[model samples]
Target: MIELNDVHKHFGPKTVLHGVNLTIPKGESMVVIGGSGTGKSVLLKCILGLMTPDAGTILLDGQDVARAERDAFLARFGMLFQGAALFDSLPVWQNVAFRLLRGSLARPKLEAREIAIEKLRRVGLKPDVADLYPAELSGGMQKRVGLARAIAAEPEIIFFDEPTTGLDPIMAGVINELIREIVVEMGATAMTITHDMSSVRAIADKVAMLHDGIIQWTGPVAEMDASPDPYVDQFIHGRAEGPIEAVR
Candidate 1:
C-alpha cells in the first residue's frame, strides 16, 4: 500500500532520512522503532507531503505521492497524533467529526454526528461523553476521542504517532489493543512510530528499525526479538551498550 525508495531529506547542513526504503503491504500494520532525532516524524511528514524531500520518491498505492492531488491523497489518510491534540474549544462530538464537517469529506450535520458517535463507541467511549468538552474528560477518554476522530472519515490509511504516550501503562495497553483491533477490522494500512515496546508488540505485524537515517532492520514482528542485528537488539532490549549511543 505504501513504498519508499531511496527517500532522502535534510535541513541545511544536517541530514535525516538518508535512503529510507520499505514497503507496507495492503491492510497490514507496520511499526517503526527508533530513538529520538532519527527523523521518524520527518519521514512521515515527507510521505504526507507536509515537508518536501531533498531527494527520492514516496508512493502510495503505486502512485507517486508528490504527483497526486493533495486533497484526494490526504483524504485517504487519518492520523492519531502523539498527544490526543484535541481542540479545546470544540465539544467532543464536534472534535471527532471535524473532518466530516469540512471540505471534501463533508456530510450532513446529523449524519456526521452519528458517524462521530459510532466511531467514539468503536474506540470504547459512551455517547454521553460526546457532548462534553475535552477538559471535562480524563486522559484516556481524550485519547479515545483522538482515535475516534482518526477513523471518523473511514480513511484507507492510518498513521499513529506515539499512540501510547502520556498514558498510564494500563491505559496505554488499552489504546494499543484498540489500535490493533481497529486497524485489522478496517483493513487499513497502518504506520506507527513509537518508542514503546509494549505498543510495538501489541500493534505491529512487521517491525522496522530506523537508525542513522535509514532502515537498519525490518522483518515480521515474530522475527524482531530473535534478530541478530546490533541496532535492532539495542533498540528492542533498551540497551545502553550497543550500536545506538545513549543521548545522555
Candidate 2:
C-alpha cells in the first residue's frame, strides 16, 4: 500500500535519510525501530509530504503522493503524534472529531460528537470522559484520547509516532495492545516509529531497523531476534558494545 524508492532527505549540511527503500503491503503493520536522531521521524514526514525529499519517490496505493491533491491525500491518513498533541482549548470529543468537524471530511457537529464517543469507547474510554479537557486526564488517558481521535475518521492508513513513550510500563503495554487491536480490527495499513522494543513486539507484523539514515534490516518481527546485522542486534538487545556507537 506504501512504497518508498531510494528516498533521500538532507537538511543543510546534514543528511537524515540516505536512500531509504521500504514497501508496506496493504493492512500490514510495519514498525520502524531506530535510535534517536536516526531519521525515523524524517522518513515519516517524507512519506506524509510534510517535508519533501530531495530525491526519490513515495507512492501511496500506486500513486505518487507528491502529485496528489493535498487535502484529499491527507484525508486517507491518521496520525497519533509523539505526545498525543491534543488541542488544549478543545474538549475531548471535539479533539477526537477535529477532522470530522472541518474541511471536505466534515460532518454535522452532532453526528461528529456521536462518532467521537464511539471511537473513544473503542479505545476503552467512557463517554463521560469526552466532555473533559486534556489537562483533566491522566497521561495514559490522554494517549487513549489521542488514539480515539486518530481512528475517529476511519482512515485507511495510520501512523503512530513513539506510541509507548513517556508512559509507565503497564500503561505502555495497554496502549500497545490497544494499537494492535485497533489496527487489526480496522484492517488499516499502519506505520509506526518507536524506540520501544515492547511496542515493536506488540504492534509490528514486520520490523525495520534504521541506522545511519538507512535501513539496516527489514523482516518479520519473529526474525528480528535472529538477524545477523550488528546494528539490529545492538538495538534490539540494548547492547552498548555492538557496532552502534553510543554517544558519550
Candidate 3:
C-alpha cells in the first residue's frame, strides 16, 4: 500500500499540498481528479520523488520512499508521461524498451527489442510499427506506444499523467479501455491524474479529488456521483456555479 501522512509542499511562498493524507491499496487503480492548479500533478510528483515535500511522510509498503535507494527504488515503478514523452530520436521499439536496455533491468539489445514488440502487440500496435519513430505515428498510436513502454518492464507500480489529454473522444475512450485492461492484467498498483470524467469512469477503481491543497474527497468510482461533497460534485459534473470559483 501507498500512504501519505500529512504531506505538505510549497513553492517559494505559495503552498500546493497542505497536510494532505491518502492511501492507495496494492493492485488498485487510484485516479486523482481536480481542476487546474489544484496540485493533482504535484501529488503524483511527490509520490514519485520527482518533487520533495516540505514535510510529512510518503510510504510505499511501509518503507519511506524518500530514503530508499534511487535506482533500485525506481526500478519497480513505471511512468507514462502526459505527452507520451517518447524520445524523438529513437524508434518506437527503442522507446518502449528504454527501461529494459539499462540499469538494474538491463537486457541484450535483441532481447529488448523482442520484449518491446510483444508489449506493443499487447497495446494493439503491430511489430512493424516498432521500427518507426514517434513523429511518424498519430496521437492515438503514440499513446499506445506510451502505454506499451509503461508496462514493458512489468513494474509493480505505474503512474499515468493525463492519459487522455489530447485525443478525440473516441480515441480517448480507446486509450482509457486499454489502460484499464493493462492495469488489471498486470495486477499493478496504478495512480493516474486526469480531469476527464470519461477516463475516470473507465479507469478508476477508486477516485480521489484534490482541491485547496488537500484531498477533498475520495471513494470508489461507484460512489462518486452520489458523493455529498460539493467540490467533487462540482468538479465531476463540470459545474461552474458551485464551490469552485470560475474565472470571468
The C-alpha lDDT values of all candidates are 0.94, 0.95, 0.95
- TM-score, cand. 2: 0.98
Clashing pairs in 2: none
The superposed Cα distance between candidate 3 and the true structure at residue 36, in angstroms, equals 1.0
- Per-model TM-score, in order, reads 0.97, 0.98, 0.98
| lDDT tens digits, residue span 113-157, model 1 | 999999999999999999999999998888899999999998999
Residue 21 lDDT, candidate 2, scale 0-100: 94
Per-residue CA lDDT of candidate 2, range 106-143, in tens?
98999999999999999999999999999999999999
Q: Each model's RMSD to truth, in Å?
A: 1.0, 0.8, 0.8
**Span of ten consecutive residues with least summed lDDT in model 1:** 239-248
lDDT of 3 by residue, 185-226 (tens): 999999999999999999999999999899999999999999
Q: How far is 167's C-alpha from truth in model 3 (Å)? A: 0.4
